[model samples]
Target chain A: DVKDCIIAYFRRSLQQGGGALSGKRALVTAGPTHEPMDPVRYIANRSSGQQGYAIANALADLGAEVTLISGPTTLRKPAGVAVQDCETALEMQALVAAMPVQDVAVCTAAVADWRPAQIVGQKIKKQSRDDVPAPLELVPNPDILADISAPSPSRPQLVIGFAAETENVEAHARAKRLRKGCDWIVANDVGENSDVMGGRENQITLITEQASEQWPRLDKNDVAQRLAALISERLSGKIDL
Target chain B: DVKDCIIAYFRRSLQQGGGALSGKRALVTAGPTHEPMDPVRYIANRSSGQQGYAIANALADLGAEVTLISGPTTLRKPAGVAVQDCETALEMQALVAAMPVQDVAVCTAAVADWRPAQIVGQKIKKQSRDDVPAPLELVPNPDILADISAPSPSRPQLVIGFAAETENVEAHARAKRLRKGCDWIVANDVGENSDVMGGRENQITLITEQASEQWPRLDKNDVAQRLAALISERLSGKIDL
Candidate 1:
């Protein structure tokens, strides 16, 4: 009788405040993918994966089954989360496509828009001084967020993407949200001297179909916590999505 | 009498195994320097700065006054070492040029060989599907290691550079050592399947005028310690330069 009572109490606790997202499933992508130019060299972005890692940790803390698909970063994996490491944009796209159904999807990785059309099998040697510099042809990579946000039976109910911009942050973010068919877009300015790409703190604008809210600069962890709380409230039917 | 006794003790200790590089000054460059494509985005490599940071710490342990010029990284600064943060290749070049005379210089940074000839003042928006992809003109960046290795009044006595290659590692490293006029070159392979660029462990080959020695794969920290010991031995006149 005592064991049964304890089991019932714990089951009920799972649906309450602290564990509001206990049964939910979430997928988050973070870090910068490396696109190869040659066997030795690659093209990459400057994303540090701090924001994405923090969000994954926050979701896990709320009892959500979180799968963090990340590129290379020095951060240790969260205790209760599953991690899938990838190197290129294509690899990340494939992994995301193969995942099970998710209630929430956060696409934060700075996927390279273009990759070398052809990768040299060996090291690209330096030419003589008189020769002209080599030309690198590029091709567009698959757009993961847009593909996932498309109307499909397996599409997540809520999809979030990030817009790293330098000018007209709100306008670009809103436009991206409409184009990609994502529910929300987190916009941040990473101009030449903004110090936001690999920095500890960030200032973001949360743009949705109804409103655009500017948030004060805060540590990446705090941002993740706030976002997690909002997601919990919305998923619990306390706030309109 | 007490002060004299203490001075004599420390002088004797300096000649032993540890602290063999006492009173030496070192300058190290690490991480990938960003080259702007537009105000919003940049061109970067996959270097994580782990190797360079480890080398800096190892050198500092040997009682060398170290100055580390680094690009964006999430790692904390090593204790007792001075760090100068930089964003773009130009910024890094200027800072390295202005540093005081050093006895040893290690160029571990994967500096972008080319930067955008002209940076767009505003954000570069995506155009319609029919529009051609944007063209990013390129210009070569200043060769920091070669400049430092040139025979000059302020040149470091022992200059080292890194050659990240995928094939013909020894040949390329030797050629680079000769062309850059550097005393030593540390070569490593970052092939498509090597998983070495941003990974924790590394395999390196130390190339000098006398010989090329291949080292077994090891953790990045251990590699740094071994390299530091070799540097100390060479600088202390225990090994030929």
Candidate 2:
């Protein structure tokens, strides 16, 4: 249904000289991954799925067959997109591993870094006022971006990750790209009261291999359009490869 | 009044930390510059003064005499900090130059790279839809990070710049640090979803001469606290010139 809406939009765009994304296959991950502590509790971030939803809409506008692996969110299903729902980081990883090869993969989900060492079948009761601060052991989660970008048989042609920052925006983002082994890292300043998340407008700096282009903050939809256009251009440029 | 507020906060932090940021003077630039297309139609970015404002608050909490040069925003003035307001990049440059020599400087503002070649006194009227787009010529603006990091009487002991990227996050951030002659760069991703802008939470990576540290997504206040702590620690670690 979402895919149909996107295709309808794309057909109209194609009429206006926008090229087709007929053969491209794209994957996107959105929202925050849950690291369950028990049957009733979990660790997660504040991702509302706005970014991922907008990207799916934008990619559909460009004619890409997009599959969105989304965590829990209330965002409307974008037109002309396929969505695979998952609850935990592990579940999301399994879904990614199971998917057929894709041309591009964008990991936008803010995956929890750690999970409880063991899942408790029942919810632990809070006993005394000082319940000894139950020591919850943590284990590291898989790096989805790095996994998708690795030289595997199903490695995506292009991989992108998000580096949201409040303080050291660029330095940290760059290191993340290197550590995660992704092709692109979109950096933003998420300091107090920033409008990028669950907000309507955004200003972004596009850091590519060759240049860093800064665009004025515009409506999120406009940003998506510009990004789609840029990606489409890059994809076309790489056709000979 | 804001200066007093910041100073008071710094005093309290000094009482807690004992010796960190004891004698350091830190300067910060915040907000966006407006490039005049005409008196009525000026170009500006959507910088909400959150990141810089939070930084000011955090720095004050770390026992530093903070000088904050801010662009237009409606945020409450942080207590115990000195602030200068400016509307243009050039004004920001002059203010930064006039400030007392500082131990560290963080250029967090989304400073405009280009300003209108000429600030037209009167607004230009749109002739017709058929008329070719009006060419508003642009002129380069000074690179604040580059200018401050260069050898000069007012050069800071340590300079930091924010690198916001959409692709190749680490490579571009590293290159930017080198190009700008800054000691540190905070690289972050402002992916298509705008996770980092005008949001209350942020995730960041810190890049320095030592190594890169990836911080999980955290509240803006926590980020400010951590960054301030790190800056204070590092400044103390350095040998006095």
Candidate 3:
């Protein structure tokens, strides 16, 4: 019954000349990537993958062929979307790199910036109580978004990145857009009491080359829907670029 | 229908006189605490609350009155268990400290050891590109397990703590038991490929004063059931202390 309802909803939209993203292909990366410390331990961020999954579902609902590349999360697969599960940052990078050119690419993953330089074959054991903490060498991971946004024949028409900031949300987001050479950046404050990391609701600022638009707090799904609508407008040339 | 089934199952267990934990009261702590960085950011760990929630559900099935104190997690509340949500380690400690003595207490929370000493009232702002990374001053949080395990008139009969170790699982667990003054410690390897932090399955070593028992990798719920059974046996005087 639910499946039929969803089909009917989409059919009605498709009949109106075109669904928002009909025939468009989208690549969405969500969740937090784990950087292996050894065979048994990893460094990870607290990203529940709710926002990214919601975005994938929203894009799918608008008739986009969505490929969701996700990190470790307990969420069920979004219906009608192709899913790819990944663990470490390297795995995510490899998967994204291998994907075909897309109309749009949204990088929402909280990718770990650093990973252990050497992954120990065995578990790194704890030493005597008096001994110092084990030394771990870390190296910067590849910047997936930057690579995807690079000037290449296969670059997506539009590349969007996310910046989860603790302070100076707008300024930092603007800086990140320039630094990464991405077309747009969705910035949000994940400060204390914001409940944005793993909570249901989010407030975001959409930073474009021309301007930054702020949206009030809303449920993650609603945010995704609104973002999808904006993406549709941008792709359809309904709004000034 | 689900509630009715659960009630029926528990009722049947109660009629058997020694339902694994009949008349027992349990306290469970789960998930990762968020220590504030500023108005919008926090320092937190990756704890899904799956293990603790599973343990709470398992104990409830055995006719124990379970109270789950959880941090931020997307998990649904376990059926028939009273839940208290908390954000920081301090809040969790307060809740546990104020409770009436529990028959058994399980500390599965990955509590943040330190919190920002001065929580900025507004969102922290990023400085110039040449500026250094923000320096965060941290202060130690109260150790809930140690406080609960202290020699108090209302101390729980059994106090169990968890040691999520990357290496030397047994030795660290053994040391933890003595340092925290807890009766038992559940030690687990969370190394590179283990996927233990947010994964569904876990392998643990249960360490007591006299002996240590290693359990094969099992689903979190199965591990909880096994642990509950062990607790039941110990309380019934079937297993030596």
Candidate 4:
């Protein structure tokens, strides 16, 4: 629904002489990484690739070449977009590392923070309550967003990261930009009623160095298109288009 | 994927400890509003109720009776959650108004910035290119996040908003928290490679009045679970839950 709404707005704006986001290349990642705790258990999320898929579709609509790197998802593929499939954060990093630098990169995938130290050749059996909780050692995963945005050989012109927070959402998201060293951040409160993950609409504020532009709530597709259009504007010397 | 991750994390945490989020109520909004131009055309976005739905499911796993006020979404409803569906910002406002005060409220829906001054009853033809550039009448929509979070009779105990920034992401998001009048704000860069919309992973910092916490990239579900756990901690002994 968000995607359809965004497409609607995009079509309308383009019809109204809005900037065309043509001749740009973008890379996006979506869904949650499944870090295995044996074959039976793994660490993953509930993401359905709705946002990333929508963005890829929107970017393509703007005449940009879009490549979507996704974890597992159930959503249908958008028309005329390339999709790269991955699982773990490490795998995502490998894929991103392999890609040539592009005009923009959107990291929407929810990579697992910690993975089991060992895949565990066999699934551990359940024991009595007296037995302590099964402990699978965790090791920190690579920071995919930071790594790509870092001073490196494949640094994209524009690198973005998602900051999903609860308390102190903005502060945390902003800090993440600096810490992760990304160009922009899309911070949303995942506290209660966020339509971000698998829903069709979303409410967000666009933060930049000079000002914060808080848009009224709209569909995620619209948000993506507006953002893409803005990206087009930035590339085309348009101010706040 | 975010919802599943949150639920998995919550179930694990619940098994590990008692009295975590035992009696809290959370309200959230997601997706885009439909600002009608006509029956054929309406304003909306690319949001896919992933984050909001995940948050609610996570909160429920932590023993909270969650009331999710979602906009349009394509994903199946999360188990054991009370869901309210809405289309416009005004509809969401009415729903939030009808509910009892919640312990925490996170407004993540992207409400439309403006709606057509009037929804034309019939679809207009594609007039000449000269007429194509004609500007459509516009009107400002309600600020639902601010309206509910403001110090009013129905304000929730904790309120949070989202900021999606391109440049100066954190600075802008922080300012938005003040401007929008919410207890906390989550800001992140949605620039290149940052999938804040429909992607699965997120990394954010938690900015509070006294301190900040930078979390590594994690699944949106993990993000939700962590937030629910943290919210429960912060609201401990303060609310009935």
lDDT of 3 by residue, A174-230 (tens): 999998889999999887668998899998999999999999999999999998988
Candidate 4 wrong stretches, greater than 4 Å: A1-241, B1-19, B128-133, B237-241
Order of candidate numbers by lDDT, starting with the best:
1, 3, 2, 4
**Which parts of model 2 have CA positions greater than 4 angstroms off?**
A1-241, B1-19, B129-133, B238-241
> Ten residues in a row with the worst lDDT in model 3 chain A?
A125-134
Each predicted model: what fraction of the native A–B Cα contacts (within 8 Å) does it retain? 0.31, 0.00, 0.08, 0.00
- Residue A133 CA error for candidate 3 (Å)? 4.6
Cα misplacement distance, residue B144 of candidate 3 (Å): 3.4
- Candidate 4 structure quality by residue, lDDT tens digits, A1-241: 6875676565445433533755567898888787765533354544566777778777777777678898867777665567788877889889988887788898878776556677764433222212333333556678788788888766877787876654566776667777778878877655445655567876676665555666777888888887777777776677632
What is the C-alpha RMSD, rounded to one decimal, of candidate 1? 5.9
* Candidate 4 lDDT tens digits, B1-241: 7775676566545544564666667787776566655433354544566777788877878777678888866667776667899877778878988998888898877675555667665433222212232344556667777787679777787887765554566666666677678877766555445776677877666655555566788888998898777788778754222
* lDDT, candidate 2, B160-201, per-residue tens: 888665556677777777777888888766544546755677
lDDT of each: 0.83, 0.71, 0.82, 0.69
How would you encode candidate 1's per-residue C-alpha lDDT over A74-101 as one tens digit per residue? 6766655678999899999999999999
Query: Candidate 1's residue-wise lDDT over B1-241, tens digit each?
Result: 5654564455345534358678888899999888776664576776888899889878877778789999877677776678999987899999998899999999999887777778788766665322335555667778888889999999998999998887777888899999889999999987667788879999999999898889999999999999999998988889995
Docking class of 2: incorrect
What is candidate 3's CA lDDT for residue A229?
89
Cα DockQ of the candidate 4 complex:
0.01
Q: What DockQ, between 0 and 1, does each candidate earn? A: 0.33, 0.01, 0.19, 0.01
Give the worst 10-residue stretch by lDDT in candidate 1 chain A: A126-135
